[model samples]
Target chain A: MTDLKLALQEQAEDVDKVLDDLLLEPEGPEAQVVKAMRYSALGGGKRVRPFLVMASSRLFGVSEASALRVAAALEMVHCYSLIHDDLPAMDDDDLRRGRPTCHIEYDEATAILAGDALLTLAFEVLADEETHPSPSVRCALVSELAKASGMNGMVGGQMIDLMAETRELGIPEITRLQRLKTGALIVFACKAGAILGKAKDIKMQALRNYGHDLGLAFQIADDLLDVEASEEETGKKVGKDAERGKATFVSLLGVERAREQAHMLSEQACRHLDVFDRDTELLRAMAQYVVNRRS
Target chain B: MTDLKLALQEQAEDVDKVLDDLLLEPEGPEAQVVKAMRYSALGGGKRVRPFLVMASSRLFGVSEASALRVAAALEMVHCYSLIHDDLPAMDDDDLRRGRPTCHIEYDEATAILAGDALLTLAFEVLADEETHPSPSVRCALVSELAKASGMNGMVGGQMIDLMAETRELGIPEITRLQRLKTGALIVFACKAGAILGKAKDIKMQALRNYGHDLGLAFQIADDLLDVEASEEETGKKVGKDAERGKATFVSLLGVERAREQAHMLSEQACRHLDVFDRDTELLRAMAQYVVNRRS
Candidate 1:
């Protein structure tokens, strides 16, 4: 694989270790549920959002541990969203990442509780003083994640997506929906790292813009891949969007235009890195990787 | 209505007003979700959890406004649980408080998002500095809520409940489950008030015990009502436990024995309040109401 692929894999492994360590505890009555949570959470994935957090935190020359909790927390919130999103009432996809969804592996009720446990656990992880030394910083992290994950952010976007599936949506409406649904957490992942790294105010703001743009680009690329990539390549069922008649960027703008938009957004995201002169190669590469990713 | 009934009605009205004012915001994409959330949270009910928080805070000489956010937050978490519990995969109850449940009123997906929103909003309300002046105190409050609402707490208990419904449960096992599921948050409610009010450590522990015992008693009484009360009187469908074939306190301990257990638990809870030299009249009255109320 390329150096970029190796770096992504390494970061994914590191974040996977962080997730496993954070999820461990002595036995309890609900140990089974905790085990179920770990089963879903620690199952290997790309770990893109956590990587963004770490990469952004590195930009400000901060220690990796300071952002580890936030990184894991982002993954927690993301995993929780995926768990719920894959439920029968939501996207109803049985397979995710080459495996059965949480609800498919566990009962739906267990899946629901597992998702709830993960979401609440994210706050608990952030609020732990041993993990996050600064109360203000912890609060900031919590606020950011809450805003991204809640109705006004990821969940709101999801509602719109659900509605848009039943009816055709224009480009503007689809973009707005994807921005909230998929992009909100992406922006949050970068902001989480920026907060932990204590980046300069101007740099932080620019990073926010970068994340917002990258998030949209990432979703567009995902939409494009859903239409273009094979199931084996994507590790997700291909053409399910078309089957459901969902309003995705590719569905609205076609594969060609969506690819162009992803490229443009990636450039916009990389432009924000110019504000930071130190250790930005990873950030720039990540922006490129966002659009170039096959899965 | 008696004097106690009149007082409860007034308290309920005041809480509704506070809820309306707190949830009110400018119209936007989030407005509809927020509206559904407010509609689920603000309607008529006992508001027992918030009352516990408010009354306990009063015991420690905190202003109502000081505890308002905590009160509202406790209610939000409670409402979220009810909403999720009413989902198709869970208990699938159609009616709550004499009206269609959130899932019944809205689609299951909307109800899911609505519950998720309320849970996130609980933390947002607590984090709002206007309501909670001390970041440290707010942090503690957030941590406490997270613990109560997460694994080894409410969610854990719910999982155990779901599992136990398929089989028999001994008294100790039932108590343990109830303690985590129902009792943990109730205990946290009282303890959170003590923390916010800056009460003495000894008082905090005592009030926590009080809340814990009260939670068990309250749950037992609920089980009793499920077996004995009518739908009109309780505002919930009667004999749901029997219909669902779930093991409740009444199912395990039988009706008379469960009532005796509830009485014993309430007495123990009231005994904990003896550590504080204050008018715990509301506390005592609430304990009595728990056992005696038909609905």
Candidate 2:
């Protein structure tokens, strides 16, 4: 196995443990909501966002405990978005990661409450002093995460995506949509370590730039996969964007041009990492992997 | 007008302004969600929760700016809950505040996204340094609010309420449900002033006792309203508990007994406030008002 893949596995396990400890079931009828929270949040996905947090924190010498807490909180937010997206009123998909969606496994109301609970729990975990000794750091984390995930960010992006079904969008409009929808949280994950460490302005800027280029490149690759990968390999209903007539990167740019664009963005992302003096090979390799990986 | 009513009216105005300022119109298609959020969160209800925060904050001399910010954040959470509750899978109500519900006005997707955005924005408001000069106080607000509204609190209460539609619940079980659903946030509101001031343990305990009794009394009064009030008087659907065969205070204890219980608890809540020597008339009157008010 590759070194990056092994490191990602270790980080994913660490985040899973934290998530398990945080989502304890209560001894009441209401424990059903927590059960749903546990079901969707546990044992899912590649944990890419958490891995980004772990990798970035390593560069700053942040403690494993603190970094894991932030990673878990972020993963909770991501999982909540997915659960909401799969609801009957939203994308209305039955399957996610090769299993029944939250609303399919549980009732719609339970799934809604579970999504709400997960979102609420993310803030709770970030606010806890155990995440950081300094209250300032905790407050900063809450502030940044809120901006990235709220109306002006992920939710706002979703509104635009829904509107896209009825309207036409150009390249610039699509770029803005993807930036808010998916890029915002990815950038947050990459920059979270610098925020925790209170690093210098130059280092923070470098990570921010790297995250911007990497997030767009990653989304383009995801669009490419949606067109090419099968449902069995992707563990989801593939070709969904095209089926829904959504204007993804590949649809607008065509496969060849879009693939080339992703490659160029990946190299540009790697170039931003040169600001760091050492120990950047993992982050650099991640840029290339986003464009090259299958499924 | 009564002094308590006057104070509540004033506090509501302050909170409304803060909410308006926070929810700006973004120049994008995503602005539709923000519009929905503003519709549901602004210009409605008695703003009783914000009134509680303002009244409590006055006791400890917390700044008006700080108090208003917390009140607005609390109201955002309250509004978000109302939006979700009125969804088809939940309470399925078509009207709130004598007008179309959020989902009735906007599509289901927009309402869901708006609710999610409001929930996220509340944490951002609480974590801002403008809410308090000290990061510790901000963190405390975030932590306490999250606990009050998350899985084991308001959301849990909603879960139990949903289950009550199918099950037979006695007084103790119903009491637990009410405590989590509506009472927890009230307790937090009553105690927020003490937290912001870093009040002594004895003082915090006194407010807590006051809040616990007051919260239960408030819920009992609410159940009574549902039983007796008209749609025109209350600005919401009447007798939903009875229609759904859900157990409530009036359902379990009868109207006369529930009325007596509300009065008794109101007086008990007032007595707990005797810890403070002066300027508590508004709070004291609120205790009586909860039981005696017709609408």
Residue pairs clashing in model 2 are none
Taking the candidates in order, what DockQ does each have?
Answer: 0.61, 0.92
Give the poorly placed runs of model 1, Cα more than 4 Å off. A25-29, B1-4, B22-32
Model 2 C-alpha lDDT versus the unseen true structure? 0.91
Model 2 per-residue lDDT tens digits across residues B1-295: 9888888788888899999999998999999999999999994788878888888888898999999999999999999999998999999999998889999999899999999999999999999999999999999999999999999999999998887788899999989998999999989988888888888888888888888898899999999999999999988899998888888889889999999999999999999999898868888888888888766
Q: Which candidate should be chosen as best, given DockQ against the real structure? A: 2
Output the worst ten-in-a-row residue range by lDDT, candidate 2 chain B.
B43-52
Q: For candidate 1 chain A, which ten residues in a row score worst on lDDT?
A: A24-33
Going through the candidates in the order shown, the clash numbers are 0, 0
Residue-by-residue lDDT tens digits, candidate 2, A1-295: 8998888788788899999999999999999999999999994788889988888888899998999999999999999999999998999999888889999999999989999999999999999999999999999999999999999999999999999999998899999999999999999999998998898989888888888999999999999999998888878888999899989999999999999999999999888888888888889888888888775
Candidate 2 docking band: high
Model 2 achieves a DockQ score of 0.92
Per-residue CA lDDT of candidate 1, range B202-279, in tens? Answer: 999999889989999999999999899899999888888888787888987899999999999899999999987787
Worst 10 residues of 1 chain B by lDDT: B24-33
